[model samples]
Target: MASPQPLNGATPKPKPITPSEISAEFSHHDPTIARINNGSFGCCPSTIIAAQQNHQLYFLEQPDNFYFNILKPSILKTRQIIKTLINADHVEEISIVDNATTAAAIVLQHTTWSFFSTLFQPGDAAIMLHYAYGAVKKSVQAYITRAGGHVIEVHLPFPLKSNSEIIVEFRKALQMGKANGRKIRLAVIDHITSMPSVIIPVKELVQMCRDEGVGRIFIDAAHAIGNVNIDVKDIGADFYTSNLHKWFFCPPSAAFLYCKMSDELSDLHHPVVSHEYGNGLAMESAWIGTRDYSPQLVVPEAMEFVSRFEGGIEGIMRRNHKKVVEMADMLAEAWGTELGTPPDMCSSMAMVGMPACLGIKSDADALKLRTHLRVCFGVEVPIYYRAPVEGEIDPITGYARISHQVYNTVEDYYRFREAVNKLVKDGVNCTLLPLCEGYAQLLQMLLKSSLPVLCISYCSAVDV
Candidate 1:
């Protein structure tokens, strides 16, 4: 029931949402922890969780009735619901997979299967951005490499100067492939990147592929579903995949893959083969190992949950975008760090720089700091480290990927801010966070009890 609103147009100010209003919608979220990492694994609302429980209980009660009757129709009903969210031409073109990774494998395996009119010829190349998800890159290597092809990476700059820079870099990659006497058979583009989260100009890039004579296009949109307004048909890619669990408030692992109807997709099949081997993508993907189908079964309720907001899904998206930008600014100013990406290039997530005093020199250091935050401060957020890219000589630095959801409030960021300030005052370095489990537990207990004096005494007396 989405209206015909412009996906990327400016929005009027969204109505302010209070914490109690958020609690009414998502009271299921744990109130103790400061959860600002919704981009990683989404927190499901209480109503959707209850609905999922009902589906699971129904399946456990009568397997045959649930599988034979509720399963197939429920899956198709989800396809119908999501078809409008992305503006797909037909529900038949959509297939619900476990997640974005599985969807990538399904398309990659089909494209590389040694059959009639294979997409990857010998010495062919597939174009991908340097910011592509690590697992998806491996899938390309597994399938495309086995087919005697190579991967061409578009080295887009970090802290992007402009969208034009991305478009220019993409053209260079396509030309580089052609210059090497290789046919660029496939182009994998991310609708929004994972670690250093930034929105890509997928529509322009898709058209650029057509102009560059690329064979096929796959949009890896793991973080695009609920955060951004999508018009998949307008983007015009051969295939697109987005994870519902990331931003759409589905349970654990539900995602949709859209394949444009064409002769090339005639041999497309799910990675897992079952009774419906020769069936289309939808039927084949329906019965993959008989797993819990709650995630996919609850799609209608999830859609309904978002529709209750003031502007429906679009309104929620605008609200989240506004909140994230504001928080990022506050953090950057407090910590004396810059924002990694601009507001226009972000959706519900933005990369805020970590204070340099944390002394994070690698991903390992970043992980240790994040662990300390979790154990001591009861804050859960993602911190990513990006060393200098290809041509840049910048030093390796850490960035906190802050995400905004309906349940989040200003206090969440304030908690994180005070926690870091305490660590800095306590002289705790990222590389030197307390590794002793007993020590961490003691500090955590003291912090939870609101006895910072005791925690400080413990910190000062404890020797690493």
Candidate 2:
């Protein structure tokens, strides 16, 4: 594979990179920053971004023609591709939405007391993992409360030893609910947990829910679309939602919601009851008023671009998973701590335990650490509160999660490693850290500091 060169000569091109060098192919990210936070909001590949831009331009050129004639077919094609990628039973079962959050909201609103009377009623219990995304938890709480139900938190361990442990915890929750005489109606589980970056056994979880007599299951697969192989039907979740912007390599506001195609969901509609709403699941989601549909239009292109990498889709997934494990291992050894998750339980993202020396106290401290890394070190990674909601409390505040994408290299993790090492060894007081010190003085301080630093030089003057 010949390395892709800049059209201009000023930018010297490295030799054609193998599949590992795929990061060089994406031009949208800031060249100066080592972006290791792809799990939060995915970075779109160059080709897919271009495809979206072209579609937007086309829409602007002829609004009536594009919306009335072109948009429906384009959306249908994208949904079809997504359906096949996830092994969904039917194309119509998938509905394009702005994001996983929206997809989840739609499901919650329709299934709760607001829409369905038989499903979620007063005093019904909705089950969820303690590791569920806060936003989705809030969504579930809102509808369940309105319907006069409460949420049952199934506490899954962070440093999980085995998948059987998760099943045991869930079984306990089910038994407790049963003893209380409360009906366990719904469960909102994760395909990949956001904070800890653990790969959940969705298939086993779904089966467990079924055996426990849970009426419906919703799988929040926000980080699973591109990072993990999705078999939606095989998982047997009644509802599933994923974001294309995160792992599917699509533009913002690109996501889909899938509902099992059966008599159970024959009348469910999109959250937004618009004029274009129809009786069918896909038809109602097709026209959610006028909005940018370009992202939805480019799903196939994103799939093609990633698939064209040296090893194709399977290859891309394998490389990312391996890279993240390698990255996690290095970081863990450097910090003298274990990788929070086992290699087999992790996909393209891994969360490593932070050093206890840094005394991170609050969410503010975590944010400061993240910002300091970005501003002073030019490394972008997520530092979060891994403090679990239940069970034993952790002594440290949280772990820092690294997301490995096709557009990343080992060099990026190296940059992050160096930065973390400096922070732990030197202990910069984030509370009083100065931003934008005089360039010359900054250089002098960098030279005088006891800890060796990687200095990036740039000049700017503040007004007297």
Candidate 3:
């Protein structure tokens, strides 16, 4: 076979989207502004929007017939698309959920933590990173504490040098957990860290979890799906959940949970709604109540849309990651900050550490930076405080994570830098501005209204 050529007909370039093109795309959706915080909730393509609308229309056209005859078949079609995209053997092992958080919570709810109560006896250890999503950390901790299990929090090094360095540090943390005589029952690992965008070596970490005789390995891959080429089977995790709404361009309520097939762990229960009392398929866990499953059904269209524009999943991954690297370089130069992770360790997102202002302590400072960038300049990105923690301190001090997707442009980051510099030069007290008025209100409303559109638009833009 001849070697495949580039999909875009040339080497993929990391150029910003032109303002005219942005206007044209937003014109289709009737939105007056471009959204830069796609990492928070991705924008769907127009195709997925049409698919969703078609499904809803069908339901309204014949409510009972659509629910009874059409819905299951549509979902099965969606499963086939998901299976091909993720390279799964059986489509039955995948179940759609609202988001990654709900998927993880459902898995947690079904597990019999008491089975490992003796192994993870009181003071027996569980380990999690400081950078893990606060909600996920809290969920895991709650489960362990109820079973009288101890929690050993590990602080991952900020501004990591390479992928291997992160793997080594994670291994060391596991060793520490074992040495403390708390047989690790479960470890919550992130395929991509929420704030830093660090792509951890999940395969190696899962194998290590198995070696430690851990009962389960739960992955919170909130930012993984469309941002990377994910083969859940290759990762060898016991349980995995990821947000299609965030990365895969599916509409809101589009996400999936995967459980490795085994007779020992076959039957699982839904988190809240339990229509299926006893079933082995993954869908049995989340498809309990009567609600619109249209978002989940539209996933195939979203995937197809992405493949049509960017060639295929691999092509899209390469382009998105390249854009993230390019944006990080441009921002670092413009802001005098440094990139935290090397190219290999980074995915389609990057974190740049900013200098802290005098007397600006805690996360409030981070909020100020976020506000200044969004209200003053229209750039939306996440700003977070990296406090001093054991084994990681200095360079990790103050940082903001910038995420890049297909819809983002280089000009967005440049505008963000200009706004922050202006605020610093003026010695402006960001908080002094009336918290209740003007640009702030506009920003708040824009973000609120954009959520559904963003979710729908992601699938439409990407097609898968």
Candidate 4:
């Protein structure tokens, strides 16, 4: 075990990093930044990225050959690996998609009938945690409303005290829906929440949905796949989706959607109804009009690469959980703020409350402060605004989402900590205070310049 090669000018601190975990494996990552934001859009290993590139080139070299002969097998193989990885009942239950958002759209679209009958009769309800991913939440609202249904949000306390607390809140939502005569037609649960990262008690939530007689259950496990051990069948959700690009160390925008293999899903389909409309979800998703399918193609290499570590993917996850919890707690202690989540409730990512002295009162402030951290200090952690609770009107605005991957070390967290400390000491006003100073001036100049899109894209697209 040794330290990874020093990134930028930072010296490698001795740790238990193996040769396979060296920086060369992650050469695509920016060497200048302390990229602790793996949960946002996962960073892929160079080897796996190379594998995808080769697959892309192979597709380009012979378009008809790749599409007609080569594509389905690669997709099927990736789905097969995912089926085994998540303990799905059958390979056909898994369909590879672009990301969790697309997977969500597919599920939500089919949840309602287009013409004669609907999954929701007039006032039926679709239940989801208030913490559901924003895009997924929007999709639920849009699709369910079309079916003459409505959305019911199950609001639970943040910095949740125990799994029991979540169970109680969800149960209340079910009962309230029932009492109000709004049949709980659908339930969406997060296997792991995005903003304030926590390992949701998904099994319990799924069982609760079943017992409550919810029509169909969808586990939005977008951040789950490589982040935790999943037994999809055991969870018993009708629909489940997880993103390989987010945590499985795969390239951008690859994920798996799992539907329970039964007569109930005979009409399930990929949202984009192309030439394969009448076919099953697998066939329909397989031929989505000839874009780069390289990410899904190289998933085998991504999963295989996990073997280079000591105990395989599960072992890597265990080590990552330990490291992230330790680092998050360190940030909380050093910043004089508390952790939003307890240790057991968290997985490889956790939310650490940022110091209040930074004047981050709104999400806008959080966004600018986030940019300030990137430009002035070269730190790349996601700064988030936590949701409110019953009593507190103004909850904490900013929490640093720290993620731990095999490529990351304690030194990265150290870099983030030092940057925040410097900001606090220097009185960098988050609002109008210091957007004119130092590197921020350069960031603003780039934004205002006719340099086209990079600067504005950097600010908005990179945030979440």
Best by lDDT: 1
RMSD of 3: 8.3
lDDT per residue as tens, model 3, 264-294: 4565656665666566545464356677778
Between candidates 3 and 4, the one scoring higher on TM-score is 4
Q: Candidate 2: deviation at residue 138, Å?
A: 0.7
Candidate lDDT values, in order: 0.84, 0.79, 0.69, 0.82
Candidate 4 structure, TM-score to reference: 0.88
lDDT of 4 by residue, 366-435 (tens): 7777877787557898887754456964456578889999889788999999887876776655665343
Pairs of residues at least 3 apart in sequence or in different chains that clash in candidate 2: 2-16, 3-16
Model 2 residue 130 CA deviation (Å) reads 1.2
lDDT (Cα, tens digit) per residue for candidate 1, span 1-464: 96566578866444554567669767666777899999988879888899999999999999999989989999999999889889998998899999999999987887687422563568788889989999998999888887787888888777775689899999988999888567888899999999788899999999999998888899999999999988989999999999999889899999999999887566789888888888888888888777798989899998778766778879889989999999999998988788888899989999998877778878877887887787667789988886755674444388999999988889999999888777767776677664456766776666556444344422553211
Clashes of each: 0, 2, 24, 0
Q: Give the C-alpha lDDT of model 4.
A: 0.82
| Structural similarity to truth (TM-score) of each candidate | 0.89, 0.86, 0.83, 0.88
